[model samples]
Target: MAIAWYIMYRKKRFDRSHDTEKVCPRADNHPIRINGSDSSTVLSDSNQSRDSPRTSEWSNMPQWLEGLRRKRVASACGIPKYSYKELQKATWNFTTNIGEGAFGPVYKAQITTGQTVAVKVLATDSKQGALEFLTEVLLLGRLHHRNLVNLMGYCAERGLHMLVYVYMSNGSLASHLYNEKHEPLTWNLRVQIALDVARGLEYLHYGAVPPVVHRDIKSSNILLDHFMKARVADFGISRQEKSALHSSSDIKGTFGYVDPEYISTSIFTKKSDVYSFGVLLFELMSGNNAQKNLMEYVEFVALGVEDNEGWEEIADPRLEGKFDVQQLNFMGGLAYNCVNPVSRKRPSMREIVLALSEIRKPRNSETYRVITEETTFELDLQGTFDSSLTER
Candidate 1:
């Protein structure tokens, strides 16, 4: 397969990215390190969260949690802790079931304070349940960004592990893409979604204190708020920069979106997340499923990295020719670089954010021309530039 970049293991000298976090490639893969960095104050902007519900008597228990009522466990991250009985009632007996994840069921609810939240109730039988629960609670509580979902609170009692999250009214990006009942996403909106998701990943890879890698980043995992703004959710499978444990313990991710090299080597890095993001670009562009490897199905189409006609075949016909040729070419071109078989060839999430932001500007402007330099095609894994990129 043609690959542009090869994975390079080296430290970057940027200011925000320090040795303390110790992240690289898919660096967010380990448990929270017990260091001074873990206690860095939560971003002040994230403090807008409304007051939590008042504590109440414990109920719906096996008589065990009752003894530990006054002695509740404190989240190491200092996030709000909710009682199991409180969450159960907030979710109205878990009746407003919204969705499901790797560990359990998610329900829509109104907490005692009248604030809306989505509660994910961990399944009793999932072996990975505890790990995923802790991962999200610890990671999200400390990491905050406009593109990342906000974790309102959490509940751990009576053999139950549940998390409370701010509700997104619009729902997952997948619902609008694959489901017919929802309205089609316009080109600008699609570009915005891509940009938003990229920003979230950029924050995880660069902005977070200990850069994180969202192991699973697909359309289904991306939620759009009422304003159509995207938020990267589901940190259950996420890892911190220092944790390389996934390479030996588990191979996680949606099948079609998994990085090819990662599958071969069983090593996931931040670039692995980039590989998945590439598939996300394809989904936004073509309105197709990546689960069946649609990227491969249209590989020839992307090979024409500069051929407008070849890319037209790749874009979602749903736009009805309303999309800009330059934007499509630039985005499709970027996506091509992202899924490069070699992880190093994939553009970093930071690079992706800048590229997408550039796409939002006027096509006739100097910035548009500047994007050309950034979009220049890199050679494949064999170190040879593929000429088929121009072939229709």
Candidate 2:
């Protein structure tokens, strides 16, 4: 496909904000959107259907990414259909409520085989509507990966709707970070989780033939299994981004995590996910409630990268000086690239995974300076990124 001049890029944009990937509604279809608020409700990607009608949004200009290729094909996965009565029995008539939101209450229950699962009850009158619900079922039913939450079954019985998922015993990453009851995550654990999320996003953006845009990627959306492995959850607002500029203007996302360019142009691409993930990366490093907005904080750190001033000041105090200086610095640089004001400048999730894989713990304090002092990764960022993207 030939590259069309990007209307969004023509104006030349700077000053970006961090927010989740979201869509504004199109002319014909008005789906109820879920806010990207933080929720520790484990495996609870509720199809919460309260009808909050969003205002009409600007139609994003058709901007074809330069040199970007689109490859996609249709594929289907088999999913079991469960009776509402069976689910009702499993949850004792919605008695074991673990979490609740716009999608309705999520109940922890047991099926006949004595397996525990999370049942997200969807509201029939939800703004998300039937089409979006079916899309979630079809999408989640077929897509499976260790880093992604699995959809076990569904119940479209009577006037009630629900989705069944493998239970996430360990809960969400947010619960571990902000919640004082849980222990603070070690630096190594944080790095590993970041890698897991990067791979998951890579699969969605590149693994899928016609890449699926996880319109919503945030800390709350990342669930941890019993093994403490991170699994990307919540396809409540996900959709496929075909080659052409999308016909609909349906932007959906949480406030703090949304990309600035996405807000300016209303044109979302795979890089939109990259921006949100950048915020997540920053959140992991700072160990703060990033949903409150981290643009200023990220900028503050990015500006300090030259002399390495205030590195400790920005790092999560919870770390207590236990982390490897090299590892922290490397991850911080990667975060800066991901959150680069220009979406095109952000490193691809594939690149993020490779970078993390290459960054290992330093041998000892004797070799720490040599390992951490090298700006090899920074050089690569400059070498690989489009120079124009770095220009204001």
Candidate 3:
């Protein structure tokens, strides 16, 4: 009896040691905050204990309960991770596609809360992969501005991923600019849109904590709200300025709107975005799509011209001579400087904002303007383009 009791004690001790030695390999798979400062509530797959497999843990829980647990975990982080079923029901069983993007198809849906939102689902064979999708969610989750699109939630389940955003009633800027079905944007409205986009870019470049470079900036990526206010959207390819500068990633952007310098050098910077914005400005002015040889058209008109001499020729014919020619000349010069082959010559977004504000100011209202920057020079609003206009 004494020997048997001693054998049982030895077996119990061995079992405890064996159990303690086992470690789950996927413990590091848990979702982490973007800042990596905390290990609190996040929305990744739950970590299973060494004693149980993840399949068993999930299989033991009811489907609805498992979903609720996910929602709660994600909600704690201020960004909810939704289930595929919830999104399917909201999006009318995935039949409400409103648009398609490089990442995937976008659908319009009204959630149970009666809030209308745009859902972007990742396509199986899309060029944009899981990394891009996660980048957008993490970046947009924290970055917020009046000019930037707002991210509402996300869905990652059953080998699917999606992002939700506030619904823009007026659709994209491209629709109004090119689609005859929609009315053309007015001159004043166009100027306002330009300022809106500039402000958005300015915020990303300077206002954000570490600064962000919107690698893709084009008319289609700019959305308009119910008030026709323009907001920059589609951050799938965006990157923080620091990471972008250090990364050796392939160049990503629309063809005609891409920075010429970036294509040759394979180095994308904030100035690259400025170059794209310059193209957008020209597109707005000419009422031409950038993909359709818009740059060639501008080059033809600007070939031998010094100072905005022939800028009037590139004006959108739809305007029918209603726009102020001075404004046109000034905008053309500003845009030309933005697209300058030398990226350093391009004006910063802050400077662009100031210039646009000056352009927006009524000519008769104030001739004397307060100069904020230490080294400030004036561009005669009434006169033609001056090289010093965009110069520091």
Candidate 4:
């Protein structure tokens, strides 16, 4: 049986690389001895032979793979080389799929260390490739803030590009808002989440060396940890601004959340992120999806305001007289300013942060209630606008 196995292995080697004569006896059969070590004990079927000396052929592996291996070794000393096959096994053939995004499918992986991680695999045919991957790696690699998602590491082996990120237990804010089973976010919690997101954006825009513009900012990209604290995720579309020369080649972001000025002019700025933040603010206040059919409602409100009419009817039904009217109005007003047709008119991220911060301050109870009640009247007037002429 050993001799027959040797013959088959020889034939396989010759077929694989036409190097049968170079093959060692131990390579062809289990329990075969090489350098006084049993082949079965020294190496597995999937890994390179431990007994085999490093060969020149090993250098012929893909450059990206070699670079990634070196990086992994430097970052994590004493860790075993995690080959693609090993990763496949760790992920159970990539069967336990968690979710798919613009990048690709993400799977939950349990490594040998017993630590669980989310593995984001990039599709080979994806329009965005190593560039996006590099963007994420470069940005997240340097950023270690609690408000920002942590990147565990990445894999670039044999055309397979994957990123390993710290898994968030609660998923994304978008899931919480859209998921039917999930409870509606309380006003205070919503404000807190908004504040957390603001701090994240502030960190990126101000804390970094050269300000970073989060070209894409939406509920889906805001991940929540076990404590429900928001962490900004998905830096694929993010870019650093040095001197205002437009860096991005394409206008990439979710509709309704993207800044109108940035979309029209193809220019990315911190204010663009602020605009998106405004949309998020609206989402939180109204308890409504920005992508929903709210154009008519927005237009009606704009028109009503233009004609000295009210707009309380368009307010989110879920709030149901529970929200502080003053805060709600401030939030709505901020959202309006954020989505303003002119980019210059939009509030800066700092301003947005300040405005949201003010909502946390104590206010006169009677005045607050009055402002809250008047929202209904204002919303009613907003419903009368000419739907055809309103800008969404």
Candidate 5:
């Protein structure tokens, strides 16, 4: 989004004159490239270069108070701050409740700039505290990718905090999977969504300077935009690692998707995220809720066969034999490896992306061309791993 000035509060009143800036245009549909520069590291006082975007005043903010005013102001500079009344008006007195999250209820609103957005209000009793809120703002401000949802603006006043995000017309992948109102997702579309998520995770793990661990990865957290393209959302529990091998004792994640190793040892790493992704893949394949009987059925079907042979039994019965047999077998094997008991045995996101690309390739050149045209992505299905893999 285009930059907006800070919300300077005075006598409990907000000066909202500078809230006119609109979010940047939506990402274009093209074959994206996956490269290190696709992501940016959170700027710290020590990392500011001469050409850095920070102003002198911002750079000179009190370093000792990193936990206080400095961190808030510095990370919040480019993001627009909306007043409570403005967001209330946008959300029609918060009556437009579309869904509820762990943090709070979500509302669909159209901001003054004519941009439709989703407003996530922080519930008073939310387990996600102020620190987690700040972490979400900081991470979304710095990290930008097509697969990641865009944060439009925020509200912090009147003892309340809320985040504004570009609204996704199709809602969540979870809804599409299990909701009877919506038609079942086609086999090709599911594969495309899986690739979208894998590329996003790849960016967080390897592309970002200081890698990020999503901490929470579930079907509900994966949203689809107007074109049915997927984006990874909800970063309240995410953490940035100083190095690739970062671990946290706090075990935070959804019940079905949580890594067994992370729960057992209380150690969370990138592989923990991979474990979660594996669960998500299975959900995509089976069109079943992870928390319900999905895993149980998978384990049962898995025990009856060797490797990926019998995974077709677990495939969504709705598909009704429409998916490619070879691809399903390959994806089953790949997803199985991802949820491996030993974290180290799981394939990295980078590897998963490449494997998915292969699995997603069409059997013939004509079909490949037609599919690429529909998605507007120039994917090179020949395994070259060209610039398209890194193009953002």
Candidate 6:
């Protein structure tokens, strides 16, 4: 029986690889014997040795055997087994839909153990499937940081794939910035959020073993918790670093956030992530969506640098002169560096984190006053505009 099992396993592997017996002579080799007994006899003895009814007794054994084997292997690796019904119950029948993206809809759920989690259920016809689910679980599960979302567990049963992550109560950074109902985030908070996001990206690019590139880094993908702490989420396009300096792939990322260099060359690198990060920083500083006014802002800033006019005039008016000019200028410099048309000119993630961190530290009294005055002037300008213009 053991010999039969060995033969079957070898044949399965060979067939899966499309390798024929004529090309591989070793495929005909018989299973080796153990002690004095034949290998086939040992497998027979072991099959019957179990007290429970033998799996072979079932008529549908062959059809179900592979799935059973896969489940056993998954279990050995500490992956949890969850039924669709269990997930449905935890999600209140999928009633609480909090968010949705390229993968699918995310629901706020409470596990039977009473822990709140965000359940990402893959769409029935999602273009991304088990490969993405496995990547996120394996990558995000092992990563632990205040700035990166935590993966609790996952379910892959009956072709229904889902990822379970810690609940982020405040939704996404994009929502907070663009949603009018939510209170405006202070400029300081926005700076801090940028710093947090930079740190997370730095960790993914340099801190992890083999490192990871978060191919998708945008406001909508950055979630905020109850305290408004930013945590990087969504890993559908993430890829592990290889020994080679260049990675090749077809263009894959959100339109406004995709790296121009990568798009042009079809080669991705850490700088690709930096480019996306720059776009996110621009969004935070300008309070504008990348898809909306970023291109115009980029053109304006380019013209400002060429024409020698200070670029500070383009700062977000909604801030009402409440932000520091030096800080804003520093952030703009970083954003400019990040969005550099030449990918090699972009600052590394480490440099980005360090630069943002420096800005967050308290400045000297003179610098503080300068920032305050600039902020006041902005507020005054906005007030003047509001008074002069009719309501739209």
Which has the greatest TM-score? 3
Off by over 4 Å in 4: 1-66, 69-86, 247-249, 293-296, 305-314, 365-392
Q: Give the winner by TM-score: 1 or 5.
A: 1
* Residue-level lDDT tens digits of model 3 in 277-372: 999999989999999999999888787555435677889988887787777767887788788888877777766777777787667531324243
Angstrom error at residue 133, model 4? 0.6
Q: Who wins the lDDT comparison?
A: 3
- What is the lDDT, from 0 to 100, of the residue 229 in candidate 1? 96
lDDT tens per residue, model 5, 360-381: 6655431122122112222222
How much does candidate 2 score in TM-score?
A: 0.73
What digit string (tens of lDDT, one per residue) describes model 6 on residues 279-351? 9988887778998868577667656542223446657777888887767766776677677788765666765
Better of 1 and 4 by TM-score: 1
TM-score, every prediction: 0.76, 0.73, 0.78, 0.70, 0.75, 0.73
**What is the alpha-carbon lDDT of model 4 when measured against the actual structure?**
0.63
Which candidate, 2 or 5, would have the higher lDDT against the true structure? 5
Tens-digit per-residue lDDT, 144-258, candidate 2? 5567888888776576668899999988898898988999999889998998888777666654434567878889889999889999988877775542135445667887788
lDDT digits (tens) for residues 297-379 of candidate 4: 56666555533223344466655666665566555655676666676656555445554665688865412111211121112
Model 1, 1-392: lDDT tens digits are 12322222222334333422221112233222222221112211211222212121112122222322334334334567888889878877888988876668889999888988899888888655566776776677677677888898887677687888889999999999988998889999999999889878877776554466898899988998989999989888787644643465467878889888888888888898998998999899999998876977668665654423456577787788889876776777678778888776666675667667778887663223222222443332222333233111
Error of 3 at 392 (Å): 8.4
Report lDDT (Cα) of residue 23, candidate 6.
21
Name the 10 consecutive residues with the lowest summed lDDT in model 6.
373-382
